[model samples]
Target chain A: DAGVTQSPTHLIKTRGQHVTLRCSPISGHKSVSWYQQVLGQGPQFIFQYYEKEERGRGNFPDRFSARQFPNYSSELNVNALLLGDSALYLCASSLVSGDGYTFGSGTRLTVV
Target chain B: AQKVTQAQTEISVVEKEDVTLDCVYETRDTTYYLFWYKQPPSGELVFLIRRNSFDEQNEISGRYSWNFQKSTSSFNFTITASQVVDSAVYFCALSAPIYNQGGKLIFGQGTELSVKP
Candidate 1:
């Protein structure tokens, strides 16, 4: 049985550039949420998608957006990246119950 | 609005010692859920436990235990006979009513635990 999976374990981008992070939830899971973990801090909510529709969004700027595909995979896109955007991006998926969330190892983004 | 606070920024204890991580949460929803996660240096959040607001019982699982107090709005985690393997960042999180909010998880700043052998 596979857990949640994320792609490009590490990434580097220049300021004002754009980046896309990918995540594939476990089979049979429909809810996927994204989080950003800055160094020395906890993971902050970004966006959540369930059944191909966005159900919630965090306080991030419009430069950050995400969408869930029909297959339940998700992509988090950040535009005009800044140095502050460098962090570990995490993806979590859960069953309909939604409380028991399983998180991926996360993609470490470094914007210079 | 939902928020979680972990006052202890860092804690150090010798192996076999006992330690407790405190978590304070604020939420308006009458019923919600609390969770504990352990993240090692490798940087992955490992789920530890989950408790709903309706259940205030203290739970024990081997060397780990949790105390949930609704009156105090606290969900505390204690590790007994701690080991070096416990060295990591522990996070306390809160989730609003799952169905209504799509299970947005609000996390605390996290407490870094250092278990010296």
Candidate 2:
């Protein structure tokens, strides 16, 4: 079985630019979530989508948004990225929300 | 609101030795779940184990063990006979159990384990 897959393994953008990270969950999975992992730190939840609806959000600002497709895939978009946005973006999927999240390799985003 | 704290930032153990990583969490909700994940240098988060709020019993899974204590809101993981492959960052996470509502996780700072031969 293919695990959660993330696109654009690495990316570089200038401040104020926008970036979108993609994720395809494991087959037969319905829940997808986004997280941000700063250097030397654990992941911080960004958003959770189940059945195409936004189920939860984190302490992040309005610049961060996400959507879940009918196939349980997901996209994480960051508008006007800041230098602090330089981190790894991770996507996780599971049969149920808020449990055993099988994570992707993560997209490493660098905002200069 | 929920918060998790991992006091140890890093630990080193010789191969074939035993090591324990500590985790403490705080939440207002009575029902929630705790989890442990391992992230190696490859940057993939690997799910290790999960413990629900009511299940405080200690669990032993081969070389991995988890001790859940509700009285102290602590969930600790121990690796016996540690191997070099166990060198990674271990994270402790918490999530609310309510459905229909989006349950986001709150994770600890993580403990980086280094196993040497």
Candidate 3:
């Protein structure tokens, strides 16, 4: 079976722009979560969704949002990107809540 | 609040040497889960192991091993006979069922391991 997959492995955006990162969870998985990892740092939680409902959110700004589809796929959106927004966006999936998670390779975003 | 701390920012060892990475966690919940992940140069986070609060048994997998001690709230990983292929950034994480946050993992800053030939 395939693992969680993320799209546009790499992306570049200008300041004040917006970008959307997509993720496809593993087949049969029902939970999806997003994380952002800056260079030389561990990933920080962003948002988590289960069954198309928002279950958890991290210490991100209002400019960051995410939604999960019925198929368990997820999208992370960042508006008015700043230089600090540049980081690797990771998507993780699990069979249910409060379980071990599998993470995707991640989408590396660069804001200039 | 839940937090994971990896005090070692980085460690370098020659091939065939053994190295252990330290991880300390803080959480009030009695029931929780701990995990270790490896992020290679390719940048993908790979699952290494998971241990619940109830189980304190140390695990050994080939050249890798994990020591979970609830007494100290420490989960340490040891790599025996380390090889250059073992070089990567390793992360320690914690998860608990908070009021609204379920299964959300709080990750440590991560420790970069460099194994040289």
Decreasing TM-score order of the candidates = 3, 1, 2
Candidate lDDT scores, in order, read: 0.93, 0.91, 0.94
User: Model 1: runs farther than 4 Å from truth?
Assistant: none
DockQ, all models: 0.74, 0.72, 0.80
lDDT per residue for candidate 1 within A3-80, as digits (tens), equals: 999999999999999999999998999889999999999999899888988888888999999999989999999999
lDDT of 3 by residue, B3-93 (tens): 8999999999999999999999999989888999999989999999999899999999999999999999999999999999999999999
Q: Please provide, for model 2 over B1-117, each residue's C-alpha lDDT reduced to its tens digit, 9 standing for 90 to 100.
A: 689999999999999999999999999888898999999999999988888898888999999999999989999999999999999999999986655246777899999999998
TM-score, predicted candidate 3 vs. hidden true structure: 0.98
lDDT of 1 by residue, B1-117 (tens): 789999999999999999999999999999888999999998989999999899998999999999999999999999999999999999999997766558889899999999999
After superposing candidate 2, which stretches have Cα over 4 Å from the reference?
B99-101
Worst window of 10 by summed lDDT in candidate 3 chain A? A91-100
> In candidate 3, residue B72 scores what lDDT?
98
Clash number for each model: 0, 1, 0
Q: Pick the candidate with the highest TM-score.
A: 3
Interface RMSD of 3: 1.3
Error of 1 at B37 (Å): 0.4
lDDT of 3 by residue, A4-93 (tens): 999989999999999999999999989999999999999998998989989899999999999998788999999999999999999999
TM-score of each prediction: 0.97, 0.96, 0.98
Per-residue error at A101 for model 2, in Å?
Answer: 1.4
